[model samples]
Target chain A: MSRRPEPVQVVKERRDAALDTLVGGLPYLAFLGIRFERRGDELTAVLPFRDENIGNPLLPALHGGVTAAFLETAAVVELAWSQLWPQMEGGAGAAAPGVRPPLPRTIDFTVDFLRSGLPRDAYARAVVVRQGRRYASVRVEGWQDNRARLFAQASGHFMMPDLSAGPGAAFADDEAMDPAPPASEPR
Target chain B: MSDDQYLRIAQQFIEALPHARVLGLRLLSVSPGHAEIELPWAAHLVGDPATGVLHGGAVSTLMDTCGGAAVMAHPAANAGAATLDLRIDYMRAATPGQAVRARAECLRVTRSVAFVRATASDDDVERPVALMQGAFTLHAPRLAGEAT
Candidate 1:
């Protein structure tokens, strides 16, 4: 006979489920090869280095755009995952099931590069500064070797959909994006 | 350096980068203090599969590449430039299946730094998908007597 599942184990299961929902659904995150982990309430995003990610082969440094993309994805994933954490809505205890938050739409983002990103597994952590009915603001820090010596810091504002509308409302594309520019134009 | 040489360097810079090639970025034009680039939409580039929208990260990559190109195009810095800071404001989600274009202008450049501003739009130039401002550290050109 199996013993009762511990509270810690239960929380981990819920978090993993939440991650599957978030990461599995987002193709770009998969394309970037981003992974998520939890230590207590903190969430970290991991981007493992690949040959294709190098921008300056001479410096052998990670591309600036790759790091920025990782940071932004980290912030968004953290925000969405928070809704599934039991402690977020309720105080401590096992997480309640089926409270996944709606995915956010980025309104603005800023990344400040403090150092050149070396080729390695990069990690990022994010904190939600404010979460309101219609918007949320978050701050993210990215580092490789030492957390104190950060490679970059980023902050962003995201538009949160109306909760009363429906779960699918947040993903709706009300505005049309760019029309495909002519690819034949000479560079 | 002549404008033609600057253009050549800018083009080579984009082509040399593997990540830019992966994103399918094309260097459209580069003049003194200004550069324009284009990114074609791909299915793997979608941020939200539910909506088939291009990820904000993809747009950020386009902006960063354009801004760096603008800084390099500036006549003052013959060497190269690195990103110091970049801020992007997402005005709207890029509609799926549409190519996005980014135009960047190096607003100012000093002894050690360059400032740039850029806008990314789909088909309509007026309706932008994202706006960006960035600062880049410039590497000064080598002097006549300076050793390599």
Candidate 2:
């Protein structure tokens, strides 16, 4: 008889692979050089410092929108991970065909700028405040050197896509459905 | 500040932002209490590969920068301001292969804060891709050539 892998190990591998797929699908995240590190089930979103991220050369601060975007991305990814966890756990071996859940859509996002984002690597973590079948609320906090002194904080509401319908089903009629030729160069 | 001064300041402000340059954000127009910026479509700005739509983050950045420009252009505001809080609502994803433009107006300026309202749209003018409202800290007015 062939040896079988432990259930915990299988779940861990699936979690990592799912996360790669989730984050890899976003071109803007790749453009901004934002990456994720998973420690157990927790995720820390990192925005590596780049000259292009600066808004004010004098103050040498990161762009406010970039900060907000980082927070929002963190929230969205966290919410998606929370939704993915249970499904991955339940269907360990019986993989559901054509059941990739679509990304959650942002309804509204509110960001509070506490301090200027310095020209350094920034980090963010998001917590899902509440997630229902159709809607989710997430709160994210971003910091540079010190987590206690957050540079920015954000709360956002997202419209959860119907997981039963599978990927692309929810956005088929919209402009997002049409796929264009791949760009030759990365912008 | 005079209209010309405001225009010059707005131009200089947008030019000084490195991220704005990276995103190729253009200052289309600026006047007292009003400013307009445009972001051309680029392959790098696409948020979703499946749909070829520009990222909501890119739109957020454009609107935020536009709001700050409007605040700076306001007669009551000074040379520099910082965003205190900003709220953005995604109306819809922007059309692919088209440029997005954001218009912002400084609705009210208090002693220490400036209020701004902004909207972003693509080719379709009737429906906006996103709407933004923000509060910005107002610095004391300074001379054109004054050092920071």
lDDT of 2 by residue, A27-122 (tens): 799888999999877999999999999987876789999999999889988987787777776655213533335678788999999888888999
Report the TM-score of chain B alone for all candidates: 0.88, 0.88
Clashing pairs in 2: none
Alpha-carbon TM-score of each model against the true structure: 0.85, 0.87
Worst 10 residues of 1 chain A by lDDT: A171-180
lDDT of 2 by residue, B1-148 (tens): 7767756776777988999988999888998788999999998888767767898899999999999988887878766888989999998878899999999998899979999999999887777889999999985223222377
| lDDT agreement of model 1 with the native | 0.80
Q: Write the per-residue lDDT of candidate 1 for residues A1-187, one digit (tens) a residue.
A: 9977559877667656656666675778877888888676677899998877777677777778888999999998887766545443364432334444557778899999887778789999999999986679999999998888888999999876554466565534543322334558542
Runs of candidate 1 exceeding 4 Å displacement: A1-8, A86-101, A171-187, B1-9, B140-148
Which stretches in model 2 have alpha-carbon errors above 4 Å? A1-11, A93-100, A171-187, B1-9, B140-148
Let me know the TM-score candidate 1 reaches against the reference structure.
0.85
